[model samples]
Target: MTIGVNCGHTLHGAGSGAEGLFREAEHTRLVGQALVDLLKEAGIYVADCTIDKADTCQEYLAKVVSFANREDLDWFISIHFNASASHKGKGVEIYTYKGKQYPQAKAICEEMAKLGFENRGVKEGSGLYVIRKTRAKAMLVEVCFCDNQQDVDTYYKIGAARAVSQIIFNSICGQCRQGENEKSPGRVQEKSKEQTTFMEFVGAIARKDWKERRIMLPSVVTAQAIKESAWGTSELACKANALFGIKENGWKGRIYIKEAIEQKPDGSYYKVDDTRWRAYDNWEQSILDHNNYIATRSTDGGRSLRYGAVIGCCDPELVCWYLQRCGYATSITYAESLMKDYVVKYDLTVYDKP
Candidate 1:
């Protein structure tokens, strides 16, 4: 099946803060390119549909719809960052029509969470043109909340685009096996069993021994780390050497840093110094922290479904979708960005090596 990837917007005057101005339109374009590169490496058909000069989301969506129709693509994934007036929220999220398209939507969302990302959950939308107009299964991923410094710092790594591309490659093609198309060099290859394991559930940990585990594909891990740690360039990653961007926000024994940001209790934005996460000293610490965070939420009484939906069940994309439903971040485009980048970047195959 053919797939299309697009960055949510051009880099020019894109806003930051809760307004999303941190990344220039050019940065978004670069991110888009990273996604395309990863997917192509996985032997998947990837389409390039970034028109960075567009002035508005409406115009951009229209261009994407037109391209999908003309290309006859089987799926369309739009990449984007999220913004909010309040920087209190964060995490990964996915969006779909919330109706019949929910199945594909579920798949997309789960894949993202498995790739790492605070599960935001899948949401239903009638206003999103890409999902409404495209003939193929369309989903959008909001990698993280740009407004939230923690989210932004965690997800906006310099090499995040490339990392995201790897995850998307594994998610869609995780069912395929390695070397399945070796005989026909020109044909697209399928994902190997390694593409669908737990390592795929979170970003790469940089653990040498991890190779022994029958974990998911390397691309997926890379994407998750990119999304969570901004491709290993976040303050947490750089200072603490935490590659996966795990936080001990509520833990009693863990260490963390605090930062100031705008927050809203009811309506107006207010300054708040929330506890920020410190990068883990080692990959295992980060992974264990992440696991605890997810597992703890999974048992939070009546809120299990909501949390479960965010992380999703066995399906990786569903985890992303559930995060959206949980309001992990305000950005509507998180999940789309992750999937699109992962598929186009050839990152999915990186796991084949030791």
Candidate 2:
């Protein structure tokens, strides 16, 4: 089946980057190209509707349907990063017209969410031109909230766009037989339950750096670390020596506070305990515990578990595996984008000392 990918209006360089809105059209263009490559790799035909980028939702979306209809494609998929009036809201949402084919739209949404994103729930669009006008089965996928920093830092920055494309490619065409045929035996091996500690787990997979590790670990432990420690400034990392953030369900641990405040509905500022966190004995244990979490969760699981399982077999690439495994990230492309940034930000290649 042929798939047309539309990068939302942000690509037309409409929004001002200074306002933090229209800054990523260039990146969105890259995202569109990435989707084309991914779809092609899956033995499917791809059309880029985002060519030359449009300014508004209406203009960009018009190009999307025009390209799809022109190609007589099977379906059109519009890729968009979402934003909310309130920054607290984040996650993935898919929209379809009110018709018999809504199930397929939901399937696409659910499959993408399998990357561990919050499900904003699928909705029926009314006036949205792409949803209303596309002759082929179409869905507008909002990968995550662009306005939310945590989502941006975690998923959007990490490559949620590409992750969503892979999911879309998988959902529309099924597993790419070539990818299946290309699977290398023993590419992914389960760790023994005994080696459940965090440091040992990372050390065990040390040969697999971010490049090699995305295939093995699927995603680096950075997300887990940031999620657990509130971006390294947490007491768990600064005080307790816990570099990898691993929160357990029923473990005895200390709680520390950093210091922050919150505004109440009454319009009063309250010294809401700024620093509340879990403490571990040391960083090594934290790393081991993190591994335990991945092993148990086993990426891209749930009703879409089969999809994740297939990717584990076929793509063996850690970031892809992680996307399939986690399947619920707010930013569908979180890990991949993050790895790109990590390599640039930390000069991580220098750390590869023998």
Candidate 3:
């Protein structure tokens, strides 16, 4: 089956997202990406219909629909998180275009409710832009409320991204692992169960950093620390308590010496030993310094913030997006790696508390 999946909203700005305890735009991307990964693993043809850039909501809706329409899709799914001004919502809901019926839609609600979220059931979404405009059968999933702490807590409890993706996968794949593609890696590779200890340990530090400094989301900091340092096992991280690979262009504090890999303009990589990296007194200091870099570093001789868009941002996806845009990392998939491989897989956004 061919499906078009859209991660709702832009990274930030015009069609950004709803902001409450967490970010709507970001979590949608997390869920959508996970779902896409699952469907593809089952040997299903998939089209990512997400449009991350738009000048207005109309543009966002139109672009996404146009992209999906271009594909000969049998199904189109738009993933989103719920939000209420009163912060009273704590449920899972799905919407189908008026007069349309999808058995999978009801199935997804029932399956998700098994994870402790109230089953809000299926509803009509006639006026929804994506639903009305898309050529294929469409459903919009509001996984849970972003503004409600109880809902967010429940979402993290069951691994929102994976649970939602798996439920959707079961609805479509139905005991069929992969259709005629046995060699395709179909099973979702879960994280090491042993990583829980390290996550809770470093999570406390990142949570403290967010609670005290209000600088960056705890999930982003914690994910960076985990991915970059191999859960605090890297020699540089152990010896100096540093996690970020931020170079030492102008440093006055202690430095950690290590071999650094650099990518040349011609897309070639070379290793250079004796490279200096900023070191800290502890992991807390390491996180603090990283946040300091995001807040303080500038290119116009300190006249303006180089990564001003990321300051105080709660959306890990948008934060990473802005950081990558501002030349924070060399990989073109920097935001993708941080979101899919770290934040969503580990359910780290639970740390993005109020």
Candidate 4:
């Protein structure tokens, strides 16, 4: 059966997020991309309805709904991360439009809980923009909280992105003996078992130096590194060890020049001249620079007073919002996008505490 997979929110524009330990947009993209790949591999006709840009939240939601409706797909799934002001909220929740629970939604949530997340159960999402507007059977999956450490650990430990993808694939394809479906159940169980050691190793390394610094939240630092450096895959990150994209404002060290996007006076973005970004000797150095960058910005000229509002803030959503207000980035929804798309979805905040 054909289905429309929407990664929920714009990849780079307005109405893009709700942040926590990681940005919602990034996590949704990662999971949505993986879901699409898995579905395609299983020979299901899939339409990727992710929006690259839109002027407003309404426009963005409309565009996604329109795309799915226009395709006349059998089902639509919007992937998202859940967030709460408390930062203690945890688990997986699925929302279908007002009345009844769709079997698919229930099934997806049940399968997701198999990955060790709390099953928050299916609920009626009456006023939700996307849930109410879509023509086909649509469900929004709030995978887990970005701010909860235990949830974050579980997300990585179970490989939620791939696991969710496999669940969707199995739900749609049923018990058919196709190549993609063969031994799927066993494989998912195997992946869950194998991911533990790797998850702990990665978490320990990411948390080590950040814990020593005791400056910004380690989850926030790691989230920014993942977003800015494309998880160490960007040219600046790999070649120069510049994980946080620190610019050469007054740096005396080596610099790397690259074309970068700049927002203009009229809110339009343009490619400016090759910008000089700070180059570090190693990944740890880059992390140290990131810490110093925020610390200096907060303390320089009484700026620390303003930064103090969010310093040691455990809420990823609040942390990101304050960072944006402090002019950390140009995007208006940068914080929300980060919290919703990356932090919460990927459980990046696990690094925040220990």
Candidate 5:
């Protein structure tokens, strides 16, 4: 198959991609180049039809279309990131020319959603210049919202450029199958077990980095991860890679908006739909950021450490006590719950050393 891939927008000046947690133009180039290489690897002819230095938006669009028209291509793809007025629009959406159906677009959207991005599905591009003007069968991909911090976090978590390229490539060329010569049911179950043990994966990552990152007491950290992330099955954990219930306040990184159940001081629970939590690229980063939050969090405008009592504590239970007393969680029995439910139940303190 011969194809033309256009990384939409310019690097700078007019027609630049959206700017939010990341630069859309830069990512477009990254993804576009990645796609070009992947298709070539699959023995398909590909052309990079990007026009990055146009004087104006109109010129940029015209040049890309003109370049694409010149190529003897079977398919044309334009990659872009969307933006919203509230800086919170999220998800992956693919577009085809008006009244046109491209199965590749549908497949790509489904593949992206598997990485935890919301699937906005394939839509008709009624007036898009790239989709409308291209001579070949055209599709434009809005690979998540640039201004949405939640989407940005997921983008990097799934390896950004490489993930996007692979999804698009696999959608068009079929996923590369490995180790699958029709596996037996027992083997399938074993693989499923391996994939489902992600909590252990997070534990291994936390243990490996706690000392180097200067985070003390992996026992408490692990317990907190278990309690907060619900053994790695919580929506926040699965979707945002957020281990702790860390809020988005004062966080410079991306944010995920999730509907969470907030506990009251009276032991009652309330539901909140717009809770903003910090998002990370992976569980390791989530653990590191949680450590930072613990070390630097303060109540009196950074004048005093909120959880200072446990800074250098050697006892795991003591650290939990300090966290509970310091208002780390809203649960009335937060410390007790972490201790009895996770730390002791799972013998987590054994991982505190080395």
Candidate 6:
């Protein structure tokens, strides 16, 4: 189907937009671009209606509506971040024209709430210019309160643009299909098995400069990369270049966002929220980041504190066991999966040699 996406506000106009932990204009554009990419990838025709420069708000709204109408879009989505004077507001909400709740809008809100935001529910927005003016079934999504620190942290933690894009894509485009024949919206193709071979994975790790940071066994690193990223076929690996499922904390570099399941205190596995992963420029950077993660502590110039037991260990099996004990993943068979299925089956220990 055809859809129109409005990024909301000019870079400098729209009265400076909202400012929380991040500028609303930047976040809106980022999320809007991501949504467009995802829609296109899912085989939907998309028209970008974002106004980068507008003399007036009235002019901006008119141009956006005009474009949507001209394109004869089936739906229009206006992406924006919410703001509050007290900076205490949080959660996700959507706006539809006054009369009734739009299914797509409701669906978007539901998917967004799955990222752990409060579901503020769909509300009437007859007064909203975009909603009122668009000819198609239209909705304005207020992703989260930009003024709230907790909300901002959550937004970044779960992946700012990438996470929001998935929610919107899943809500509108449904599931993604595999082959060349495009399916209807709401049906995504299931992902296939690992695409890269074990030797290729080992070679990738071996080519990296892990000499100084060889605290974690190379074989262990290779196995975890394979298991976690599915041999470079997982969305996080392919899209974001995140090989080890490392969550974004204080990373200042690029980010890749995706939904991740986590184990709770009760040992029940639940899709906790979208995780923001550090996006690398290349696969080698991902490998290096993985190396640094398991090798040292914050005090020792590394990012983690739990993997000390595995650090400096040369045995792949021992490293896997130690990582499992450190709660690297919730799977009860995580260690065994690496040891038996990956390391042993692939003969990954050869890569650990100096």
lDDT of each: 0.53, 0.51, 0.77, 0.71, 0.77, 0.73
Give the per-residue lDDT of model 5 (tens digit) for 74-153. 99989999999898789999888783657788888888988899999889896898888889988999999988889988
* Candidate 1 local lDDT, 96-205, one digit each (tens): 76544455445545655554556777777547777788877777767666667776555545335545554555555563222333344344323455444433534345
RMSD of each: 18.2, 19.4, 16.6, 15.1, 15.5, 12.6
- Ten-residue stretch with the least lDDT total in model 6: 177-186
Clashes found in each candidate (C-alpha, N, C closer than 3 A): 75, 39, 0, 25, 0, 8
Candidate 6 lDDT: 0.73
| Candidates 1 and 4 compared by TM-score, better number | 4
User: lDDT score, residue 296, model 4?
Assistant: 61
Worst lDDT run of 10 residues, candidate 3, spans: 180-189
TM per candidate comes to 0.45, 0.46, 0.52, 0.50, 0.50, 0.51
**Which tens-of-lDDT digit does each residue in 1-354 have in candidate 3?**
688988888877888878978888877876776676566433356676877778998899999999899988889999888888788978989888993557888888888887788999889898998999888999998888999998899887887676677777776556533332244433333545546776787788778877887777888888777766766655577788887777886767898887664544432233466899998888778877888887788888988998888888878999878877898876556677777667876788888875
Candidate 5 displacement at residue 119 in angstroms = 0.8
Per-residue accuracy of model 6 over 237-349 as CA lDDT, tens digit each: 76787777787756778987766655455433333345787899887888887777665435434565667888777677888999888877776667876786567756677
**Model 1, which residues run further than 4 Å from truth?**
13-21, 24-27, 55-57, 99-116, 156-159, 175-354
Off by over 4 Å in 3: 176-354
Q: Which residue pairs does candidate 6 place in steric collision? A: 173-186, 174-186, 175-186, 175-187, 175-188, 176-188, 176-189, 177-189
Q: Which of the two, 3 or 4, has more TM-score?
A: 3
On the 0 to 100 scale, the lDDT of residue 70 in model 5 is 92
Task: Flag regions of model 4 displaced more than 4 Å.
Answer: 175-354
Q: Is candidate 1 or candidate 5 better by lDDT?
A: 5
